[model samples]
Structures are given as structure tokens and as C-alpha cells.
Target: MEFYKLKANPKRLFLLDGSGALVSAFFLGLVLPSFGPLCGMPKNVLYLLSVIACIFALYSFACYFFLRRNRKPFLRGIALANLSYCFLTIALLCRYSQSLTIFGWTYFGLELFIIGILIRFELKYASVR
Candidate 1:
């Protein structure tokens, strides 16, 4: 884990997280809705997820710009938020498993995997001095 680089400049983490969250919001809120039938996830649920992503993005961006120090709490906050999102997604997946298409499963699975990786980095760096 190249936490040394992150420790040197934790601001970069906020940027990366914010950017990823924006992408998630865009896809979930705008792009995915058009493919609802193929994805087999409701539009409302996707929009809700997108809204959450937007909130995450806002928090990350705010931290990046405004936080001069004491970032551990914010980092943990995002990590926890990401964990909560993963759990919510898992629950949704289970609830909609019967209706969710292969594409939906694949998409959500990839999202979970990616976020899980990010969460690991966030948590690890948050623990460092």
C-alpha cells in the first residue's frame, strides 16, 4: 500500500474521491436512468443513489478545499459513508435480485468492488499519523 504518498498529501485523496463520486452521480442519476429496462433497477432507486453520491462528492470537495488539517475524521466519515452505500446496494441487490438483469448485477458488483478498494485506501490512510 503506497500510503506514504497519501500521507504526504492527503488532499489528493479528497480530489480522487470527489471526482469518483461525481462520476457515480452522473452515471446513476443521468446515464443509468435511460437504461432502466436493461439494468432492471428502478429509476427512483438509481436517482436516490445518485443523490447520495452527489452528497459524498460535495463533502469530499469541501474537505479538499477547506480542510487545512485534521482530516482523519473526514476520511473516516467518507469511508463509513462508502461502507453504508455498499450495504445499501447489497440490500437493494437482494431485494431486486429477481428483477435485476445480468447487466445490473454486473454493474452494481463492479461498483461495490471499486468502492471497496477506495474504502480500504481511505481507512488505511486515515489511520496513519
Candidate 2:
């Protein structure tokens, strides 16, 4: 779907954000932690990231379901949260660069790229009248 069309119905952004956060939570909380040796991120750190993702998911989903109007602030809120997540991921990546394997680098790089796109969409749509 062309995201530019989302200006007409911005609530869909919440669904997209919530779904992405849910996936991030699952991977960070479960899948990646189990493969800690390969990913090279500490399990506790992975779990911490997962918990943050879960919170983001809840906020997005809540806004998607309950907020009937005035969603701009909420959309921006999630966009900011996602941006923060990217920063945290970058910090973790730098801190763990020595231990992080190719897979870890690739995973986080892809995740940041994807979330960056989502943040752009969210911010763009939120700015629309």
C-alpha cells in the first residue's frame, strides 16, 4: 500500500505500528534471546528491548482501538517512541559491537531501516491536517 494515501485514514498507522512492535517484541523477547550466542546481545538486554516493544505495541493498539479523534498527538507519540527505540538499538549495537556477530548486525540494521521508514510515515501523516 502506498503510504501517502494514509493521509485520508491515519488510524491505519496504528495498526501497522502495533503489528511491527508485536513482531519486534516476539523476536527480541523470544527468538533472538534463544540464539544469544549467534546474536551476541545479552539475553537480559534483549528482554529489556522486548519489554519496551511490548509497551509500544500496547500504546499503538490502544490508540487504534479507543481513540475516536484527535490522533495526531498519539501518532507522533509512537513515532517518537520508535525513534527512541532505534537510538537505543544503535547504542546497544555500538556497545556490543565486539561481541555482535554478522547476524546481529544484519538484524538490527534491517530493523532500524524498517522502523525509520515507519517513523517517516507516522510523522508525515500526523503532520497532515
Candidate 3:
């Protein structure tokens, strides 16, 4: 087993992450309600999570602006914000497990996985190297 360090161009990382977050925000908020219950989340919870995704997407874009400015401190703040959001998401999912249907759980599990990956990249690249 080996621990490989995450490596990438910081600016590119922000751009790609920003794109992904925006896409997720779109699907989570706009597409889900079209076929209610398919998402396995209660209507209210679904809307709430969708709004959160939108906010996350906005923050991701903010990260891009920070990267554009070459401001290390703001980039660090974005990374920390991402970390905090992911943790909060996981906690919310766990606490609301009872509200989640099978599909809901699966969807959120995948969300956590992707967030975990992105957060790793952010934390790694944001650190002194």
C-alpha cells in the first residue's frame, strides 16, 4: 500500500471543480423534482439540499476567482470551506438517514465520495509543498 500525494495545477483544479459543482447543482436542484420520489428524498429535504448544492457551486466559482488573483489565503479559505461543507453534508446525511430512501442513500453516498476526492485535492494543493 502506498499513499500518493495529490498533485495538479491549482488553477485548473479550481476550474474543473467549479464546473462539476455547477453541474451537480443543476441536476440536484432542477432535475430531481421532475420525477418526484425518484430521488428518494423528501420534497423539503430535496429542496434544501439542492439549495446547498447551489451555494457550494457558487463558492467553487469564488475559488476560481481567488485562484485567478493568485491569492493563497483566499484559496486556503475556499479549501477549508469545502472541507467544512463535506463534513457537514456527511453529518446531515447520517442524521437524516431515516428520511432517505434507498436511492437517496445511494445518491448521497456517491456525492460524499466525489466530495471526498475533491476535498483531498484541495487540501493537498492548498498546503505548503
Q: Pick the candidate with the highest TM-score.
A: 2
Query: For residues 1-129, could you state the per-residue lDDT of candidate 3 as single tens digits?
Result: 011422445666666567767766766777776668776565666666677767766776777675455545655666676677678777877777776777777877887787777766666666745
For all candidates in order, the CA lDDT equals: 0.92, 0.93, 0.67
Stretches > 4 Å off in candidate 3: 1-8, 65-69
Tell me the tens digit of each residue's lDDT in model 2 across 1-129. 477667777899999999999999999999998876999989999999999999999999999999999999999999999999999999999998999999999999999999999999999888887
Winner by lDDT: 2
Query: On lDDT, who's better, 1 or 2?
Result: 2
**Per-prediction RMSD in angstroms?**
1.2, 0.8, 3.6
Better of 1 and 2 by TM-score: 2
Residue 43 in candidate 2, Cα distance off native in Å: 0.5
Q: Considering summed lDDT, which 10 consecutive residues are worst modelled in model 2? A: 1-10
Looking at model 1, the pairs that clash are none
lDDT of 2 at 19: 96
Q: Choose 2 or 3, whichever is better by lDDT.
A: 2
